[model samples]
Target chain A: MSEAVSALNGQSFVGIVKIEEAGPQGMITLRGDAGAAALQKAARDVAGVDMPGIRGIAAAGDRAIAWMSPDEWLILLPHAQAHEGVATLRTALAGTHHLAENVSDARALFRVTGEPARLREVLAKLAPADLHPDRFGTGEMRRTRLAQVPAAIWLDSAGEARVICFRSVASYVFDLLSVAAAPGSEVGFFDA
Target chain B: MLILECPCCGVLADETELAPGGEAHLKRFGPGASDDEFEGYLFMRENPRGVHFERWRHVNGCGKWFHAARDTSTLEVFGTYPAQTTEPPRDIRDRISARRPGWTWREFA
Candidate 1:
C-alpha cells in the first residue's frame, strides 16, 4: 500500500486515493482509407500478423493487441518492445497508403481485476462498452467514453481487463475507480 | 436526445456523436447546377414528419459517416448504412410496410 502511494506522488489527483504503478504500454494509432489494401498488406508485412476481420480486437502474442475498424486500428504493445515494434511497422509500411503514429506516451493504463460482477458494477458507472458475451467477449476491445473520457477497454483471455485513457485524465478516472472499489476491494496499478 | 444509429459501429451512440445532414437522396438538377440546385444542396430541407431518411456522421466513434432512416413518430430506426455505399441496409423491407396517410416516402426522398 505504501509502495503504491509512493508511486503516484506528485501526479495529478483531485481526491484522496491510492495509486498503482502502471508499467509502460505502447499505443499506436493507425489511420488510412478503408480501400487501402496495400496499407493492410503493409501492416501484415510489418507485424507478420494478419489484421482481424471482425469489428473487434485481435491479439498476437503478449506483444500487441490490434483493434479493427473500417479505416483505423489502435495497436497496444508491451512497454519495452514498443519502439522496436513501431519502428518495424513504420519501416514495413513506408510509402504505403496509411499513417502510423506512435502514441505510447500519450495514454495511461489501469488494470481492473477481481470478481467479474464487481468489475462490471464499477464499470457500469461510466463505461459505454458492451460487456455482454455477444458483444465484448474475451479478446475483444472497445473504444468508448468512460465518465465522458475517451477510453479503450480490452478483456484478456483470462478475463482480466485493462482500461486505457489519456494521461491528463488518468487521475480523475482513478478517483472514480477508488470510489467504485469501496470496501473489500483489491485494486492496484500494474507496474510494467 | 436525437437517436442516431451508425452503420459501421452499430446502433449505439448518443446524438452528441452525430451531426444530422437533413434528408437523404437528393437529386442534382442542371449541368452547372442552377441557383435552385444550389438552394437544394444548401438550404432546402425535407422537414420530414414520419418515416424519413437522413445522413449522419459518426464524429466520435468509428469516424465513418453513414445514413439512417427512421420514423419520427414511432422512433423506429428502419435502416442505416455507409454513405458512399450504393445499397443501404436490406432490413428495411418489412419496416416501411405501412406508410402514414399524408406522409409519403417520396416526399422525404
Candidate 2:
C-alpha cells in the first residue's frame, strides 16, 4: 500500500508569518447533538475525546475536536487511524440522528504561526472573520470563506492557526497565503 | 455587502456566504384554501420601504437558516433572529420602532 503525502508536500514559505502544510492529519466531519449524553459517550469511545461545545475545542493527547456548528464538529486525529476512527464512530452512533464521515482525503490544511498581529494581517486579506486575539482566541473554530473558498479555521493553544479547505483549492490557498505573507505587501503601510 | 448574523452558530456571515430566502412570516395557504387566500400567499409580497423581515441561510458558515429585520430603503438592519419562529420577535419590532418612529411594516406599529 502506498502512503498518502500531504496536500502541499511539506511546502513552506518563511515570511513574517510562516506558511506551511500541517502534514497529513486525520480530518473527520462529525454531526450530532453534543449536548446529548449518548453522543458524547459515543464520541469519547471512538475518538478518545469529548465533543466540543459551541465555538469551542476539546483535546486529548493527539486527538482534537473543533466545534463547526451547533450539531457539527471536525475531529482531527492521526492520519493512519482516520478510516478506523470513522468506522468506530459509525458503529457507536448507529440508530442515532448523527453522521460521522472521514474527510481526510477531501480536505487539505495549512498552518500559519508567528506574531499574532502579522498572522492576522495575512488572513485578513482573504478571510473576512475578525482575527483579533480578544474575539477569536485559542481553541475557537469557525467555518467561513477564504478568498471565496470554503474553509474551516481554528486557533490552537500554542497560537498557531490551522486553515483547512477543499483539496481542489489547496494550491490556490497556499499561493494566496504566500503572497499575502510576503514582507512588503502590508496594506496601508509603506516604507518611510 | 450585507452582513447577517446566524443565530445558530453566531457567525456574522457576509452576503456571499448567505443565501437570501425572501420575505419571511408567510402564511402558507395550500390545498383546499380559497383562491384569494392562495393568491395572497403565493403572489403577494409585503415589500415595505421600511422594517421588512427576511429569511437568510448561512450557506457557507453553519448552514442554518435565520431571520433578519432591516429597512428596505435605508438598509439599516434592526437585528437577526433564529428562523424557528413564525413572526419577528418583539425586541426586533421595538428596535425598528425606536429608529423609524411611527414606521409600520407588517403588523407592528
Candidate 3:
C-alpha cells in the first residue's frame, strides 16, 4: 500500500516567522444552514465547536469549525479520522439539506508561528488582508488571495496562524511564505 | 484602486480581490425574440460616463456576486447591493438621486 505524505514532505523554514507544513490534517467540507440547530449539534458533537459566526472560527483541542461561506463550513479534525467524520456528520444531518465531504487529502496547510507582530508582518507582505492585530485576532478567518493563489487563513492565537490552500499550490504558497519571512526581509510594517 | 463593499461577506474588498462582471440588470432576449432585440441584448450595454450599475464577484472574499452603482468617469460608488435584488435598493437609488439629480441610466432616473 502507498502511504500518504504531506504535500511538501514536511518542509519547514525558519525566519521571522516559522513556516512549516502541517502534516496530515483531517478536513471536511460541510455545507448546510449554519444556524440550523441540527447542524449546530452535529458539528458540536463531532468537532466540539458550535457554529461560528460570519467569518468566525472556533476550536477546542484538535477539532474546529470555520465559516467558509454563507452556508458552508470547513471542519478540521484528526488526520486519521477524516472519512469516519464525514459518515458521522452525514448520518446525523441526513434529513436536512446538507453535504459533508472529506477534503483532507485535497488541500495543504502551514503553520506560521513566531512573535505576533513578526508573524503578521510576514503575512502582510504576501496578502492584502488587514494584518493589524486590533482588526484581526483569534477566532476570525479570512478567505483571501495569498500572493496569487486563493488561500484561507486563521489566527488560532496572537502568535500562530494557520494557512490552507489547494494541494496543487502548496509548494507555491510555501515559497511565497519563505521569502516573505526571510530574516532580513522584515519590513516591520506591523510592529507596534 | 477601487474598493467596494460585498454585501455577502459584509467587507470592503480591494479591486484586485474582485472580478468585474460587466453591466447588471440586463433583460434577456432569447431565441423567440427578434434579431435586433437579441443583438441589443447581447451587444448593447450601458456606457454612460456618469452613474452606472455593474455586477462584481468578490472572487477573493466570499466568492459571491453583488451589484455596484458608480460614476463611470469619477469611479465614485454610490452604493452596493446584494445580487438577489432585481433593482437597486431605495436607499442606493435615492442616494444617487440626491448626488446627481435628473441623472438617468437606462430606465433609472
**TM-scores of the candidates in the order shown:** 0.75, 0.90, 0.96
Candidate 1 stretches with Cα past 4 Å from truth are A1-21, A33-49, A157-159, A184-192, B1-5, B14-22, B26-32, B85-94, B98-103, B106-109
Give lDDT tens digits, candidate 1, residues A96-170: 777787776677877776555555555655665456545556756666667767776666653356777787787
Q: Candidate 3: which docking quality band?
A: medium
Ranking by TM-score: 3, 2, 1
Give a tens-digit lDDT track for model 3, residues A1-192.
257788998899999889999998999999888678998899888898887889999999999999888988999999888888999999999999899999999999999999898998888888877778877889898998898988999998898999999999999999999999998887877777
Runs off by more than 4 Å, candidate 3: none
Q: Score the docking of each candidate (DockQ).
A: 0.36, 0.72, 0.74
Residue A144 local lDDT, model 1: 65
Error of 1 at A159 (Å): 4.4
Strongest candidate by lDDT: 3
Q: lDDT of each prediction vs. the true structure?
A: 0.63, 0.82, 0.90
What are the per-residue Cα lDDT tens digits for candidate 2 across A1-192? 479887889799977789998878898888877777777887777667777678887788889888887888888899998899989888877887888888998989899987666777788778877766667777778888888788878777444778898988999999988989998776632212
Please tell me the TM-score of chain B in candidate 2 relative to the true structure's chain B: 0.94
Cα lDDT tens digits, model 3, B1-109, are 7889888877678888899999999988997999999999999998888999999998987889999999989989899999998778889999999999999988877
Q: Give the CAPRI rating of model 1.
A: acceptable
i-RMS of candidate 3: 0.9
For candidate 2, give the docking quality class from DockQ: medium
